[model samples]
Target: MDIEIFPYRVLGSDTTEALLNDLESLEDVKRTVIHGPRFPKGEATLPPKYRERRVININGEDVVLQVKTARIFLEITMESTIDEIEEICKEHIPYGFDINQDRSNYIRKQQTVTDRIKYGDKELPDELVGMTDQYSTFDDHVKIIKKDD
Candidate 1:
């Protein structure tokens, strides 16, 4: 099951960071993909505090956010988790947000023609099937955060 968190306005780095931390804490929220316009690469046009690509701590790992956080796609374990996710969004997205449950598949589970072109015949792991845009290299976009004992 999957749910899409669509905020009325683009979310900043701090909101994205806090929202991700909260959502990821839920066991039912299996996987997440944050989608938005890519931040421009170069000297910071905005002040340091307003920068969009700032590094954020998810769990314990610090990962740099590359997108402006227009929409957040969460893959959950069951349909019941939708309400729980809604509550979380209610608290985080004050400007207004929608919990879209209608989308049958927010996260892609199958490989496409683009995937074939990017990866050839080499098999890809299930978790990485649609985590990235075909135009971008996998390493540049995908960051798998694993905890250490």
Candidate 2:
């Protein structure tokens, strides 16, 4: 089942990076995506600290964080793995977070008309199926991490 992790406060770049690194390390975790409000594009007049994009290191890879972390959607097979995830969140997310399991469709389950039009006759991997909304692009919202082979 898919689980949604809602943090009490909006997470910054550093916290998001740390939390995602730990969550991606879990064996039971199949896929994970962070969803949140996008930072404004025009920040020229603002100070550097208020800059929208931040480069965060994940598993030694640098990823540009474009939004503040609002909710994390995780796809997992084992229910017990939620405990481990909670432990990780507790360590990094001092503000607190709630894990919701009641929702049946946290992630999309079927392909839409856009998907059909985007890649006609081509098949999309299961991991890429429901990662983004119809209006948004994958790179704008979805971040895919695979375990080492």
| Candidate 1 lDDT tens digits, 29-74 | 7788999999987638778875778789999888888889999998
Candidate 2 regions with alpha-carbon error over 4 angstroms: 132-141
Per-residue error (Å), model 2, residue 14: 0.5
Candidate 1 vs. true structure, TM-score: 0.90
Candidate 2: lDDT over CA atoms? Answer: 0.82
Error of 2 at 74 (Å): 0.4
Clashing pairs in 2: none
TM-score of each: 0.90, 0.88
Q: CA RMSD for every model?
A: 1.9, 1.9
Model 1 residue 109 CA deviation (Å) reads 0.5
Off by over 4 Å in 1: 147-149
Per-residue lDDT tens digits of candidate 2, residues 1-149?
A: 89999999999887898899999888898878788888776855689886657788777777888778999998898899999999999999898889999987688778777777655658888877765466766676666656786
